[model samples]
Target: MIVASVPRTWFEEAVVVFFDVVRGTRAEAGQVLLPDGRALPGVRLVEGEHLAPGAVYEAEDEDGRRQDPERLRIVERRAGSDPAVRLEHVLGDEGTVTVVEGALQGIERPVAAQLRGSVRGLGRWGSLRRVHGEARVGLRAWWEAAAGRHVSGTPFEARLEHRLAEATVWAVPRPHGAGRWKVRLELSLRGRSFLRPVAAVALLLFRNRLREAFTDRVDRLAQVWNEIVLDTVSQDKSRLRERILDAAASPPEEPLL
Candidate 1:
């Protein structure tokens, strides 16, 4: 997600933190070296028309190593507008994995989990004080067995939308046969208001600190979600699953935002 309100100083610090989290090291010529020794290419813009829908493109690692080709399909495209792209990966003898952008908005499944919280704080500057706001999380998950009985009892397609005081999150899970699932998650942070006098002064005098405060709070919420939900699903440990189930069943009484 793009955050236009963040100051350059905070943005730079965030970039460092983000790369560190991904175990990436900066390389020459704007490249990044991954933990596995693969180089991540810098961002480059491409003409939308040149990327024809339903076309297959060769996949290559950062080091230009050949891998399986990926199929590309344009899900939605409009002139003078952003296009939604769909990518599919075919695993020979396994299953076909598909990811579609702008697909979550169409999900109609009922919510299977939820949480709520609120947070408020006074910043170093009085004008940078945060207003108390509520956070709501809704999750819908499904599990499908590879061969035997289906576990989790959730629908094959799941959608989650978490509305935080400062941000919103949407996630969708898609199943690729062979017990594999792919999830697409999007996070959007609310833009800051600069029209107010106090806010304007804060933006001019303590923009970096404000940005840092916003990012740090959002990061904490994200970390909690990862630990309580995503991590459990990834490891697939039965004991952890119980904890997730409990959390889902029992909503927090205190504000967590």
Candidate 2:
């Protein structure tokens, strides 16, 4: 299981609006476009019932070997206070995962939200064990000494754990004026057992490639989010943003693994 929080900025708009728009849309599976222009197919939301506790939805995905169906149940909803919702993913006899989202305390300008996720029956090394992970995202204010102004953005953290290994990823985006942002990302992995030795060897061999792949994924995700916001909310289109959207919709050069 892995939990991750992603903070995003969309054209000086409220974060809540972004959240609402995504929640209201019917999510398509296997359609997510990767930075490398590859498409992952076999997952889609077949059903959804508003956004409240007890509401159940159906999803289907191709798990490489066959079609796998799953159910998503709303575990909690708090519309009156922090305006948050919790969802649980049930994978029949396989396992389950839960995700929680809500507003962060004490900050409001950027309309920050916290994300938490956990999973069960997910482990490597074929032990039929369990794994867990969690992530958090919140808004923070910082003073730009050069610009002499205060700005805000989201900081993200994620940690995943299994009996044989663990991984952590963190990202922080800094504003560079004129709606441009630079993100700093860090990833660390540790492991034990025979798997650890193999992973260490792989890391030593493909360290640069792995880092490049991770960076590319992050960059693409940010681009996709920006593209979605621009398509759904804004009419004005800059040349750079338009190019990004076009690339996002382009076909991959090779098949996804």
Clashing pairs in 1: 117-256, 118-255, 118-256, 118-257
Give one digit per residue, the lDDT tens place, for model 1 in 1-257.
Answer: 11112122332333333333343333333333344444433221122433345434333443444444332334343321222234433332232333434322112232332222222222343233323222222232332222223345333332332222244445344544443334444544433443345545645787678667766765675566555444434443434333433443342353111
* Candidate 2 Cα errors over 4 Å, as ranges: 1-52, 58-69, 93-111, 122-129, 142-154, 192-202, 236-257
Q: Any idea how many clashes model 1 has?
A: 4
Q: What's the TM-score of each model vs. the native?
A: 0.25, 0.55
lDDT score for candidate 1 against the true structure: 0.36
lDDT tens string, model 2, 126-149?
Answer: 243456677776544321311233
Q: Cα lDDT for residue 39, model 2? A: 41
Model 1 TM-score is 0.25
State the RMSD for candidate 2. 9.6
lDDT of each: 0.36, 0.53
Which residue pairs collide in model 2, if any?
A: 29-43, 29-44, 30-40, 30-41
Best by lDDT: 2
